[model samples]
Target: MADGQWWRDAVIYQVHPRSFADSNGDGVGDLNGVRSRLPHLRDLGVDAVWLSPFYVSPQADGGYDVADYRAVDPLFGTPADAEALIADAHALGLRVLVDLVPNHSSDRHDWFRRAPAGGPGSPARDRYHFRPGRGARGELPPNDWHSLFGGPAWTRAADPDGSPGDWYLHLFAPEQPDFNWANPEVAEEFRAILRFWPVRGVDGFRVDVAHGLVKAEGLPDHGRSARLLDLTSTPFWDQDGVHEVYRDWRRLLDSYPGERIGVAEAWGRTPVRTANYVRPDELHQAFNFHHLTCSWEPAALRAVVDDSLAAMRAVGAPATWLLSNHDVVRHATRLAPGADRARAATLLMLALPGSAYLYQGEELGLPEVVDLPDASRRDPAFRRTGGRDGHRDGCRVPLPWHGDRPPYGFGPAGGPSRLPQPDDWAELSAAAQDGVPGSTLELYRAALAPRRAHPALGGGDDLVWLPGDDAVLAFERGAGDEVLRCAANAGGHPVEVEVGPAGELLLSSAPVDHDGAHVVLPPDTAIWWIPARAPRAAPASAPAPASTPMAAQTPTRSSTSALGPPPP
Candidate 1:
């Protein structure tokens, strides 16, 4: 193993601040709420906490539309709360990583205010993409490209209509205009921002929508409007010149001494093309959201895994995997009702040979909240749904800390609570499932704890997939002296898998059937085994002593009847 390479096999827990916990009765989660929950996270055994944007913003795009990159949003908490989180997280031996949104800022940002007027010599003026207007309507200007959240890419500025003022470009929503990376000042300006946070003790950053940084020049008009669409922004996104920008940023981050992880949110087509962002100096890893986004099917999963592996091997690039994030519906709902396949997916995720990011509530197997009142919905996607299914607010619901709270363990309790407690948390709260033998949460702990202890599982290379019944995807991971085999059942029915003589079951999501030449696995489950006399296998390790058993607990919480649907 390499020094500080632990992140290569590490599992990152992504905490969405607004829904994590609310400290005061303001009905929003804050940093202090996060600090209060540190013990729960530490006990969960994550390598690091990847916090979503907490920067100052106008709240038009959640926190993505940053107004002041350096300051914390008062809604989230003060800078001291952030410092306290870092201090507490470090004390628990967990690393901290913050989100860095370099693509764009809110239209309300100070830079936009000064630019509309002829602030000719202003440095911030050129930071945004500004071009001469092109449209029939004096108020309405520019291209036919639609936003990712569903709307025209360009909006009328506050400036006088029919003026010669230039129009700004926003790929996602009109509220969030894209930045001009072509400007050397913008690139250097962000590099300076990168250097500023490490002083506050952030270990690294999760670069949000990184490939969206640069846009094609010439300002050509897109032909049609399409929701969740990409207009190519002039063909500059994911372009060749991006590599130089990454290289420059990497060099600047290297000055921090210890390794600084840079995992890019790269959303592109082919796995091979996405791998280009993960080369040695470009970016430590480019997130692999392919499998997570696809429909649940064995063949699909197999193809994605194979393609991803081939892509990385071909480019000699490191890889990172994410099953779900704030943007989409929760995996539990995707896999089965109430996220039934969460444990099985978790097993497969960790068994893979790369870094993995686990979204909050995934361990608890929480389902996505589909019903949100129009008055409460906040996401742009939900708004455009025409009062149909709510947007990401369902997946972004507040963390369930206790069982008695509303929404089956989500926001604040009773008539009123200090934070936005869930209505009925007893069903899915960590306290409710911690010791249950068959709980999804415990199974995750059982499986993940071993990865940290076993070098073969954590640091091996050269994984070989062994054929089994169509239901099972069997594979062995080994590099040099370390070797281990993982056999998993990806079907709804049990399947028999044959390994070798005298192999022992190290961990199982269900009872293993070790009879005859083949072992049987329960429906939608998996188990790992090691050779009895392998030369390079890491020594066997046990689950932490304090971990509780499943049988002793009763369902202490109520149903989803208590709390209302998630915030809009």
Candidate 2:
């Protein structure tokens, strides 16, 4: 990859500010907290850090409901603290990408606040999706669109006439009113917000809800499916006009000295539709949610991998692989049947032909804290849905840096964390795994070291799948002497396979036994091999064992044995 185009194959760490670290005793994480953790990221060997929203907010949706784009929230820190964090990350040779919520803003936002006080046809109301209701007395919403959290997407607006008046559209929580992108003033305001961050030395932005910015010309009812996942023909998402908005943002980003990028957090109906967001003239990259949502079944995973690679190649953009982020359950808990499977998945993801994103505590193999108290839940979806499937707070608990108790060194001594962290996280704390051999932290560090040092490992769109059983997925990256082979066994038992000319074993997610011509791969494992020679004859299958599959066992809290012994 070119020096300036560092993001193409880079490993970007997603840091949710409120959970990463808390420098202050206020029980909240701040930018200064992030600045202090720069060395941890540098040592962990990530190329960049993608911070979730820290902009001014009412904390309605974990900072996603932005009150101001330009200012840092007091809960996070001052604008100076943000600049210092950026400078510190750069000094550690890490790029900084901040989250930008363009789809909506907090109802407390200056524009949103002023818009409600005006009449239906006022200029202030035009800045948002403000329209009169369908019924004669304006009792019903303008349309039947539903909020992503739940309930009606449109909420009644208090009018200047002191009557139940026009309803404004909010695709998410009512506190987060969607912007009227059709308004010229809205587009220009965002362009200026785009310019504001780069001036502070931020490398780029991870554009929140990028595909939901522009809606259909008419605020029509979403006739059939109101599900958020069905974005293909949706009136509110992935509209054609969204591309023009991105094209404009692209121009502003490219104007900067560095190859400043815009990564779309877009969800599309198909890989091709998702790829459209990253066309040459538009955004630089988009999160591959297809790969993230794929199951552990070999056929499903292979399909997603193949489709993702082909789709991204079609757009001349590198595929971005992410296992977990702030909104979903951590991959360690959601994807794998056990810790071993999670480790294998990580190895498989890192070896893929694209950029990779790592969630904050994922390096330490943190599992989702699924049982946070109802009172401690802060996600808007949970409250809006009356505690249904909106359990995102489980994945946003504070990180355990050190110590053996609550807060786990996340904040000041004896001070509680903003969200309840599981007591079992003591074993997964960074301090506990820092130098331990065979630990998840070590495996990640070891894996990333070579990924950065090896030319064939990073930044390439070349992958040739090797013939193997349905349970095993093997592929070679690059070609000739610069080649590296990666294989994963997503099965119930060990499988022996011929890895063309038996190269040197660089790393393995689990222990492997090689017998010159055939390599025995354990179930729920993956490996990276550096090629040493040409193709070899295939090996015969070994007899199946009578024991139960390894998937039956629940992984222990601190199970580094799942990763096997340290690399020789």
Candidate 3:
């Protein structure tokens, strides 16, 4: 979107603001905290930083329920702080992406607060889905749609005369009332919001609930009391009208300078349907939840990767791959008892030809805080589901920056952290692994180095999968000296992968033994090997240095994985 396809291959870091860092000893991450940490992202070699929601909110859904699109929440910071942070990020050569929640708004939002008071048929109430109940006394909900977070999607509202009134639609929590996209005012308001940030140097937006903006013609039943955690389409999600909303947004983004873009958080049931959100006339990209939810098996991983690329390519869009995010279990714990498999998965995601997303603390090899005390949990979904679903708090704990105690260097000592920290994280702090050999932090840094320096890993390459067993995946990119070959062993036993006879090993997720033609890859290990570069020929006008030897043609592959992790 930025004149060329810079985002197509970018390594963008997702910063869960509340858990990223606490500035002013406030126990919550604000814009200034992120600004202070901009250098860490720059030094980490990522091209952009995608910040989670910090807009004015009641924290009912962790800032996803916006009370005001143009204002920053007082709990986080001021508008000035956000502007300064954007300026600071650009100064550090990093682009910034802010979250935009378009599907719903906090019930406290101005328009929503006035909806019930405006009565059922009033224009003010028309902005949102305020409809009459279905029963004889208007006591039943309009439809049986359930909230994505849990419970019924419909919530009864009070009338202007203080009598029982209409029911409003909320796909998430009751505090978040879904807007009526069919209302012209709804689309017009978002158009203004789409223009608000890009003019202030904000690079793009990560649109939340992109596909759920429009529901089916009538408030039809979804056939479930609570929607299961699957990407299946329903009457309330991924409807056809959602694409029309994005096409309008895409047009607005194109009108601005600096390649402003929009990334959809759409959950289409199939890859082809998902691709529709990223067509040239729609939004620029969409998150690939398929990869995030993929298992630790080679066949499943290959299927997702192949399907993602094929579908995205068909629509002339770049595929996005990621292993971790704030809402899911961290791969470290998901692929545990050791970090080997998670580390390998990170390498595999980076090796694939597309944009990559890195969740906060992932490079430090942090596992999800699966044992957080129930009293400290703040996820609304967890609260509403009666504790049966929604375990996202485990992945949103404050990051350990340095100290060896709870709140582990996340901020000043004694700061009131919004979420508790794990004391054990001190050993896994970014400070502990900054330059440590073979550490996950170092592995990420090393992987990013070549990706930034090599053309083969750039935006234009295609992945060519090689023949391998069910437990392994092999692929190559580029041609001749620039060719980069990669293979991963995702099984329980060590494997000998035939990667080609004339390449140099650049890096691997785990230690290995290789003889050019074959690499004895350990379980859960992935490697990056490139065709060995040939020696430079002497200029026609000058002879080569006498010290230069003929044997240089067969230089050994350069690598740092030889002393890394071994098969466990």
Error of 3 at 500 (Å): 5.1
Q: What lDDT score is found at residue 89 in candidate 1?
A: 85
Per-residue CA lDDT of model 3 for 1-568, tens digit only, reads 2445678888889998888888889798777788778777776778888999998899998899899999989877899999999888888777889999989999989999988888879999889998899889999999888887888888999998899999999989999999999999999999999899998889899999888888888877767664644556478778888888898889998897767878888877877988999999999889998888888888899999889999999999889888888878998998776888898888888988888989999988989888888888888988888887778988888888777786776778878778888767788988877656567777787777667666678465398988777788888877665667787888999888765565556677866776656778889888877644522222111222223221111111123222222111
lDDT of 2 by residue, 461-490 (tens): 888888878899898887665777888998
Choose the strongest candidate by lDDT. Answer: 2
Cα lDDT listed for each candidate: 0.69, 0.83, 0.81
In model 2, residue pairs whose N, Cα or C atoms come closer than 3 Å (at least 3 residues apart or on different chains), thus clashing, are none
User: How many clashes show up in model 1?
Assistant: 32
Please provide TM-scores, in order, for all candidate models, with all chains considered together: 0.88, 0.93, 0.92
Clashing pairs in 3: none
Off by over 4 Å in 1: 119-125, 136-140, 160-165, 224-236, 337-340, 385-390, 407-425, 479-481, 499-501, 511-518, 535-568
TM-score quality measure for candidate 3? 0.92
Ranked by TM-score from best down, the candidates are 2, 3, 1
